[model samples]
Target: MARVSQEHLDARRRQILNGAALCFARNGFHATSMQDVLKEVDLSAGAVYRYFSGKEELIGAIVAEVLETVRDVQECAARESPPPLPDVLIPRVLAQLREVKPGTLGNGEWVFPRLMIQVWTETLRNDELSALMTAGYVKVRAAWANLVESYKVAGLMPEDVDADAMARTMIALAQGFAAQVAVFGAASPEVLRDGLRALMSMGEPRVRP
Candidate 1:
């Protein structure tokens, strides 16, 4: 078969991805079917298959899209603000996190956090999904490292702060925190804000006793 034009391919792929995200959000990833996505996009099953071979690939695309949004937000935050990096970064990160808040019942909170946890859990059982999640994590961490590095270059951070390590630490905290809130619901945004403010402040010089 002839390959479709790149622009047409991308546009059609995006349509499927958007529909997949909505389906995954409403019904957890495991519960959503390719047929449901086809209906969501007003496409027939064959049309959906043309864009993506299967549901897993569609989910991968949706996750990639979310990761891209995170990268873009972090990038813009780095450029548009003078940072304590955490100050600028947290608001953007938290804004995304807020989508999953228990009270809001927003689509983002329901679909994304739940689907992400599902993906992470599935990674242990499935290698392809594991690889996709790992790649997504690495990309997100790299975006964060660049953001943290901006603070170091500005002298806002202590010279000793390890940008790469700090980036991983940030991702770890978010992953753990999301799991925590999803499970136990102990830490809310206010708790995270105050805690992160203290953690981020470590770079600041301490007063002499």
Candidate 2:
């Protein structure tokens, strides 16, 4: 047998995961099945099985993809000269929320945010998924914590500001936006950018008055 190229393997895995993502978005994870994914991919049982054993593994891959994407976003923001987060990071994030990548299920639909919401519910039942969420949360929190600490050190933010809480607030904002998109359709990038700017202008809360 010819050696499978890494690119080919990656492409095939993405194909399976994207199909599964759409299925989860359409019918929540509890309702989704390996058979549904098989139909979505239009692949032989052997072919699909080679990539993902079942819905469990598929869900894990989906969660991992999200964490990986977030890490990439952090890395991208860090690489910029002054980290133009609003000018750069927000646009990239909006693109993911928009599901700019190819592979449509039907009728030009994109199911990323809804699929993510389903994954959140699945975490309550699956220990593995819950663990993945916890671990990913820590990584995300740490990334934001570092960013927050930098502002604090620069005397931009208060010294007593809780980095962890601030990080969670940011995460909450992003998740809330995703939830809205998941329910309604994707909004224009400018709309999201404007909203984020307004939220930023409010500034991180210091104490409840």
List model 1 lDDT by residue over 1-209, tens digit each.
98879999777877777677767756667788888888888988888888689987886776676677777767776675475456446545756744422222252244445555766766788788778777877888888888887877777777788888988887776667667655554455566667878876676678899
Off by over 4 Å in 1: 1-15, 94-109, 184-191, 198-209
| Clash count of each predicted structure | 2, 0
The worst-scoring run of ten residues by lDDT in candidate 1 lies at 100-109
Provide the overall lDDT of each model, using Cα atoms, as 2-decimal numbers: 0.69, 0.75
lDDT of 2 by residue, 70-113 (tens): 76676566545555544345556647645533343465555777
Q: Which 10-residue window in model 2 sums to the lowest lDDT?
A: 97-106
Task: Report the C-alpha displacement of residue 12, candidate 1, in angstroms.
Answer: 5.6
